[model samples]
Every structure is written in structure tokens, then in C-alpha cells.
Target: MTMQLAIEVDRADDPRLQAYTSIREKDLTSGHGARFIIEGKVTLETALRRGRFKLGSLFLAKSRLEPLADLLAQVPQDVPIYVAPQDVMDAVAGFPMHRGVLACGIKGDIPSPAEFLSQGIRAAAPSTLLMLSDLSNHDNVGACFRNAAAFGADAVLMDAQCCDPLYRKAIRVSSGASLWLPYAHGGTGMDMVNAAKAEGYEVWAMTPRAGARMLGTLRIPEKLAILLGAEGPGLPDALISAARPVRIPMSSGFDSVNVATAGAITLAHVFGQRT
Candidate 1:
């Protein structure tokens, strides 16, 4: 792809930079429509490389242009690259904007849960799937994605109660994994589990409740869905009853683990089983 000319913005309030204004505030607001902000060079590079959405624009600190030259050269000619001095960049972001690399992406279309489950169906072996329910914390959600991707999960599925994985902090926390990992978000927790079952996946509901099966005892299924829930209440009893309840055996004093940590351990086990 031909590299686009980098536009220099001397003023922080340049109209061309409207999408980037008050960025930290916008990250918390639900007014973005189809737009989402990507922070730092690593996440931006992921978007440019494998992200499903089309990049609307890139806002960079002047000093970042040279260091990111190799990666920036791959930008599509239609995407504008805006370069501003450090002070101006910080003024627009409403914070320090320390990473100095930011970009806007237009979320065009997301696959439905059924559509996501259909992936890799014809292959000899099914890919692992990670499902989340009511995980409101962005950091936990991001860490779950990072763990899922690290363990080679094919996709992530989140119920309606889960926070948006595209949220700026979540994406950054995922180390850009959210940018490339295929995910479907919507419907109730049971809806996700039911869909996976229809696709021939054995659903494993992760919980630490009494009588739950130990993670080590079961053989990994060719098509498996590992379901995780919020930290405090854990999965709803009704949802847990709908799937096989499984738990990571902990010490005598502890009955639970952080949702994200549980996910990593579970996924890592399934990964080990496969190898």
C-alpha cells in the first residue's frame, strides 16, 4: 500500500482532529457510534495488520513518526495520518497521552455468536472458544482475551452483560489481542452456551462451587467452550446448571481465583492437553 502524507497540526483544536478530542472522557462515554479509539503503537499496529475494522485515521505525536515509520508505511493511502507535537497531542487527549500513538477505527460489522461458532467447522479439529458472562471489569475482560489468544483460542464470546472489549483500556490491556481475536458479544450467558452446544462444543462452566469437577480430570474435547463469569458472584446458578461446572483445584484456604487468572489456567490446561 502507498503511504499517505502525514498532516501536521500545530493547534490542538484543529477541526481535522475532532475525533481525537477529549479522548479519555470519550473512552467512558457511549456516544462513539461506530468509532473506537486505539492507543499506543502496538495496538495501532495490530489494527493496521489484522483488525477487522477499517481505520478512520491515525493521530501521532511528531516524535513517533520516525520510530513508527516501518509500520506506518503499511497504512492504506485513504487513511489520514495526523502528527502533532507532544504538548498539542496531550492537550487533545485530556491526559498525558504518554504512548504517543493513537488511531480511530470504524466498527463496520461484527459476527454473530452463531457465525463465530461456525468458524473452523470443516477442519479436522475444532479450535478452542472462550466465553465470558457479566464481566464488567475492563481489565479482567482484556486479560481474558490476552489469555485466550495466548493459548490459541479461535475466538471469544461475551454475553450482553459483559463490558465492551473494544473499550480503550481493555484493548491496551489485552496487548492488542482484542484487535485481532475474533469475538462475538451480545445475548444472555445461556444464549452463548446454547449456541456453542448447537455447534457441537462441550461447554465447561468455570466456577469454584462445591461439587464442581476438577479441571484436570476431564479430557479436552475437540470442540470446547470455556465459560467464565464475574469475580464476586461468579456464574449464575441457572447458567452453571446448564453446562458442566468445572473448577481449578486451589489451596485449602482459597476456593476461588480471579476470573482472568482462572481463564489462563484453564486455557493453558486445554492447550497442554492438545499437545
Candidate 2:
């Protein structure tokens, strides 16, 4: 196999790998707007191959290189690839990284949530969209991304309060679909609902509170956009009042479902209807 351009670094303090240092899940938000860290071999490989994000650098454990030879070969020679021992890797990240794979990436000209939703509106064909608000959990957002990709949602629209899908844990939990799927962020819950409505979309707010149209018999719209709020106290009253509220059928006594699981079921139902 062709060799990859990988540089071996001796210490965690190496200046060349500044981007990959001190990596903790919560503290990594500083890179959300521009750069992100890709963990695990699959996530790193997918991020590089998709070209959705600019790969700034790579850090690898000595043991992982041979297994990841093919993916490594695909990385740009100009991009600095650093290999270090797992001890230093754990120290830099503040935890043991059993997978021994990590890469740093910077986002490019991806559109904002409102902008992407607008494009879907202008398109000739019907579009499937998922929107989220105040979803602060990375795992939930990651699972949502995976579900969207699996169900072929065109794009994900999230509000300013939603967790970053590119967060390392989210990216990993998503099995790397977080890098594969196209997503954008902006606005408030009400603002997003209004945007969807103005663009000729029938915004379906997923909620369990009173006044929700049961999702079972609800007709999926030709131009559909699903809006979801964070777990617990889902879509606010004003947003619900502005959009058509829908609820998944469950036995009596349940207040709600996991946001990601609900999204998956709803996306599948919408896909079946639209198709």
C-alpha cells in the first residue's frame, strides 16, 4: 500500500499538534464554529474522505497506523500527521482513548440552518428536514444525526442552543454519521418555526403535551420539516401554537420519548408517506 505522510511526535507538548491538545468533551466547544476533533478510526476516516470538513491535522497511536494504512494513504500530504504513544494521547485528552485515533478538522462554507432549509424550499422536489432546539446533549444530537442519515433526511436544522454535532463524543457516538450528514445551526425555536412556515413548509412540532395531532394518522406534507425540542419540556408553547403539533402513539402514562428515537420513528413514518 502507498505510504501516508505521518510525522511522529515525541511529547504531548508538541507545537505542531496544538489543535489536538487538551481534548475534553465539554471544553471542546471552543472549536465548534470552525474546527472540531474527530475520534476513532471510522470517524476520522469518514471525515477525511467526505471532504465536508477541512482536515487540519492527525494524531495517531503507533499501534493504529498499520490497521488504518488505507485511510492514512488518502490524507493530503501537506496536512501534518502526527503519531504519538497512547500515554501521551491519554494525557493530552485527559482520558484513555482506547481507539487510539484522533484527527482535527475545520468546517468550510457549510450553510446555516435557515439557509439550508430555504434551499430545500426552492428545490423542485419535496425535501425532508429535521430541526432541533435547545438540545444540549451531544449523545442525543449524535444519535439524531445517525437517524437522519439512515432515513435519508436532506438536512438537519438546529437552533443556537442545540449541541454541536461535531463534538468529539457526538461524532464518535454517531458512528461518524455526524461528519457524513449536512447540518446547520441558528435562531430560536419560534424563529425557526416561522422560517419553516415562511418557506412554504408545514412545520410539525414533536411534542407530548396537550393539543398534539396523533402522528399515526397525520398526513405528511409535501414539503415537510420536523421541529424537535430538547428532552423534557419539549417545544415551547409559542412554537407549538405556531406550528402543527404531532405526538407519537404510546401507552397511557408516558410523558415523552428520547428525542433521537422519536426523530427516527417520525422520519421513517414521513419517508414512508412521502415515498
Question: Would you list the C-alpha lDDT of every candidate in the order shown?
Answer: 0.89, 0.81
lDDT of 1 by residue, 58-113 (tens): 99999999888889999998899999999999999899988899999897666667
lDDT of 2 by residue, 1-275 (tens): 47666788878877887777777853554656577888887787788777477788888887888888888888887777888888988877778989898888886666666676666533555778889889999899989988888887877888889877888888888888878677877778777778778888899889886668889787667778898888887888888888888989888888688999999999999887767
Off by over 4 Å in 1: 1-3, 118-124
List pairs with backbone clashes in candidate 2: none
How well does candidate 2 match the true structure in TM-score terms?
0.92
For residue 146, model 1's alpha carbon misses the true position, in angstroms, by: 0.6
**All predictions: root-mean-square deviation over Cα?**
1.7, 2.0
- The estimated TM-scores of all candidates read 0.95, 0.92
Query: Over the full model, what C-alpha lDDT does candidate 2 score relative to the true structure?
Result: 0.81
